[model samples]
Target chain A: MISGPIPPHPRALLQDLWLEPEATGLAEARPSLKVSSSAKKKDADPTTRGPKAKASQGDLREDDPRERPPYQGNLDSEVFHLESGWKLLASDLCFGKGLDVDFLGMDANRTPIAVLALGEEDQDLCPLKLLDLKAWFQRNKELIRQTWMRICPELISLDLCRDLRFFLIAHEFSPSLIERLSCLSSFDLLLFRLRSLGVRGQQYWYAEGVAPWAHHSQEVSPFEAPSGVEAELLRERINTFLSRVQVVGEGLVGRSLDFEGDRFDRRALIENELVLELGVDQGQVWIRIPGIPDEFLLGTDEEQSRVLDCFLRSLMARNHPTWGSVPLGNSPRKPEQTQNEGKALGGRPEPQPREDRLSSSEPEKDSPWGRGNPCRSSKHAERSEGTRLSDEEMAAFFGS
Target chain B: MAKFFDRIFKPFQRHVALPSSLVPPVVGIASGKGGTGKSMVTVNLGVLLGSPRARVRILDADLGLGNAHLPLGLKPDRNLQYFFEEKGSLADLLQHSRYGVDVLPGGSGLSRLAHLNPSDFRRFALGLDSVLEGAAAVLVDSAAGISPQTLSFLLASDLVLIVTTPEITSLTDAYALIKCLALRRPGRGVSLLVNQCDDSQQGWRAFEKIRDISGRFLGIHVSFLGAVPGDPAVRSALAARTPIVIRTPSAPAARGLRACARRLEDILEEIPQWRKVPSYGRRLLEAQR
Candidate 1:
């Protein structure tokens, strides 16, 4: 349906609609109007250009930062380089902080041919179509396939993914496209944060129906199969993810599922390089990786065990610090064993008066942490130095 | 003709077309920890205190790893790196932000600064002073830890704001930092700002240990400036790359930062009155001689 004359000065109209102070929602919705006229056409002409043509038209005044004057003040010399590129892109870099995905269309030589700036949350408020790619390449699939093959040297071949090349679905994704791109792996299609995915979110796998070889086209192969370096990186990432999950679990009491167990399963997937499992229970999500044998850790290295031991210890400290430290490998705590195991420990304490601790002497030295005392020399240097405020400071600090 | 001539030379009479005497004292936010809320506080406080005429310049001194642009949601047409590389004056590197505040991004490829002779450091300092000549206040967010960059910038600034969280480790490190600065510049103008406080009381209590220890040992009183409460809104705003002062000014954390800004004002007013204690660096050199 026509929204009437479509407001000639669309950005101006958006500004008028958004400056209300209360118009934040509409303000955030402004970037959508920048999409090309082609996006507005029904599968109709299949021949209209988008961001490129519009970009040339200079309709995206917001994107052209030059309109803003350069800062003219005492500036640090080195930060100038990053300031230009560190902009809030019209789109989210990753959708909902889920996956990190890169779509690089390359040439026959596998050189960088084209980089796709995928739809970000703010940019594509409305649903988007993968078919947009056809427009992106001007319906030149063969070239795209060749470029894909060249870029994805590890993938089997582009021809195999012809059927699953690209498709579109009417769906809405939350978080942002950038975040979604961060969590994706060809072998693993798990959603890290299901809560942020708005309704109608679904995966459209272009390589779904293709043969393993076809799906693993040289262009898409690297994404399909893990490389030696990638495998190692994934292992480290999985360990980090497991640690973060354990941290998250500390706050979850009687959660929907065993987050820590699921983390182990994901680690297993990375270890075995076979079978990916993604599931959700209540609010907790799980990705039960398969194929790793139970004997993988028959005699784990001291370093690996130490890391695990430290991780488990931190989790216990966070969840049940007073219950007493549990030794690793005694079998996970059962529900009965988990209850009322110990007193509350490791919890942060309340703020108290501290300035009085100082002697009102000649030096005016008031470091409660003993900034200069020779008597406490050995004990002084070991403490972390991050600032924490006193009670009166906090009160008067925020009260103003 | 006489009046016109007088007006023409009026601006040059002062030798510097500096900002009004009412200009607020520039306070820098620094930390020994990486993940502390230095940038967050600096950006928010700038917005709170910023005005068209009395503008606040947030100089991101984190250099190579600066993230002030991320929290403020601003993208510059040119960054400070270009200025440093091209021998551009600090004034050349200043970039206007979407928010009303002005910005002077730190250089990223400052490995050169690492090897810079004293001449280069002097030129850098002069460029910065020129660039900041007319600002109402300059809020510097320094790189984490005691790198040369952080120390150089910290020493150059009029006031230093040390940010830390409530963890014991963080507090301990904060005290060590105070001790370092005190030992280096015994009476350096420094203040403490606590972030991610469980409560107002907790924030103050967290600084209490450091305040007392520093007072008793170092013979220095690092002012307990203020604290920002642990607010999820701050994180969400950061995730979205928006400043919370604009997104949710009424939030506890925002309010806290504003209060700190005010406290900073009061502290700044008292600076000239406080005796300048020789930085320990100077004292140590003298002692060695």
Candidate 2:
């Protein structure tokens, strides 16, 4: 089988039905559609009486025979090269085996293309005919190459026929024909409506549809490096930040700091348990503690104050003795005094009474920070105190 | 009486369980995203698994854009499309490559084969049964992502080998594929092979992260097959149109692949006899429904 839907014409349907069975047997028995090389001279002559008789016997009969267009005989092949960029290599390039392409030409990309022109008078032109052309091309690419080489040896140096494209130039394409052509994506087939315009007795042929070979180049250009003073400043800032951060995991690169880069969210192991993910969005630095739902923004004063105080308090409470050796550029104070004073200086809401704080902690049974009445323990109270520190104290603690 | 009944009815069963030797385990290699080296792993593993005493066949199931034969340095004249169209048998399409592997090439740009009807699926399954006869193992290189066709292949196989790189995107996609597979075939186990790793440690770390997340969220166990290190020789071999295992057998990636192949062989050997039926095509057809 034929894989796609058939056109509505009964004759075309019948031909399509018989195409598969006859594809091999008919290869030898079918008559050649190509104009014979011996008949080239006669076909080329505009003054010859043969095409006039043939045109009259078919559809091109005018009211008077003398009113026939001047460029009537053998003009189908020449019309492609008149104004179109296509340069014809051979006309009626015969395979000599009942198969021939109308015009063999090279596109701008130096890719070989087979052009088949369907005349209005040709009764045999159908979807099955196009299929036949494609099948013949597939089977005899080397033969077509040899014939082209025999005709013009120098043009063979351009490129071999790795992907030969087919073009059907017709007066009008039926909807069914377009549908049939759409199914043959592998062939890279193109259909063009051949528009014949007579301007001041000059016949001009325009191939109107987009050529398959004329697609834009799909090559991707390398990304250009960022330049200018702002870019340099941003790069320097990001580099400085990354150089200061400690990256401690296997195969873990330094936390990427550049906001504009694709890997802006940098993850680094903190305290050997928590993952510190730092990212920048809209010129504001944001930090997220992975496995925790809370996000800390470091761009604004209030958020910076809250996050820094919380971090320092958590560290100090968790490792109180090691807190003295942190080199935070400040003297270590008692955990109780640091918690009380940090909250007082930070302009945060006043802490509830010790009993109320203890009561609130009861409902936080599953909190990662701790379970049940954190204020009941002096260590938990100190850590909670660290979460409410002043902006100035945090700035001073970091020596920024 | 039991022997007489067995003799009378065994030949008439629709689901005939062939001998384990005749019904080689089908391993489907897949990825969540494209360019994760699924085909590369499948081809190299086929070569590693093949020996004088055993035979391995690779079926290129990436219908539209298959390049599995590229590494083998064989350009097949016919492919699965010919077999699908009845122009040739599955045996006719099997091309022997340089490294003692049989490849059933998936012809490029044949989109029709990506989706098969019921009859076509039966024909394809029967064709595979004939092609895979007497093989020790059959590796199916599936197209990346969770397309219906890829899912069908994964569902049909006895095992799925998910290939991924250390990149976050690759890991995320691999997880997505595991999630999809878990939702569809919850009982099936998938093996993870991290490709292009900086080291075995890095590969293990990536695998652990994916495994932990999958276990916690999807409640599925992902087996760690192993990792193939990123080696320059692999790229050079690819450019030269050869498998790195054959071009530079001692290279880090090749050695890693050999170790992975051994692990896979051990796993295949442990499979029970009842699961060794060559019914991947039938399973795939049922999955498609």
Residue A215 lDDT (model 1): 18
Shift of residue A200 alpha carbon in model 2, Å:
95
What DockQ does model 2 achieve?
Answer: 0.01
Across A1-400, the per-residue lDDT of candidate 2 in tens digits comes to 1111421222121112122123223333222222234224323322322232242233222224345334332122222221112334444455544355555665434556666655443324445655676677668767656775655453464345545656666555665555665555566455555444444444333334422221212210111112223324544554444444332121122222222112233434332223344554434456654334577765445655565455444433333232312334455444466568767898664333444554575543332332211122444333333223334323422336
- The residue ranges of model 1 lying beyond 4 angstroms of the native Cα positions read A1-400, B1-24, B108-117, B271-289
Stretches > 4 Å off in candidate 2: A1-400, B1-21, B273-278
Please name the candidate that would achieve the greatest DockQ relative to the true structure. Answer: 1
Scored against the true structure, residue A303 in model 2 reaches a CA lDDT of 59
Quote the true-contact fraction of every model.
0.09, 0.00
Provide the lDDT at B262 for model 1.
48
Candidate 2 pairs with clashing backbones: A346-A390
Q: Tens digit of lDDT per residue, candidate 1, span B37-60?
A: 888998877765554334577877
| lDDT digits (tens) for residues A78-165 of candidate 1 | 1111111111111111111221112222222122211222222223522133224323444555654565335334332223322222
In order, what DockQ does each candidate have?
0.06, 0.01
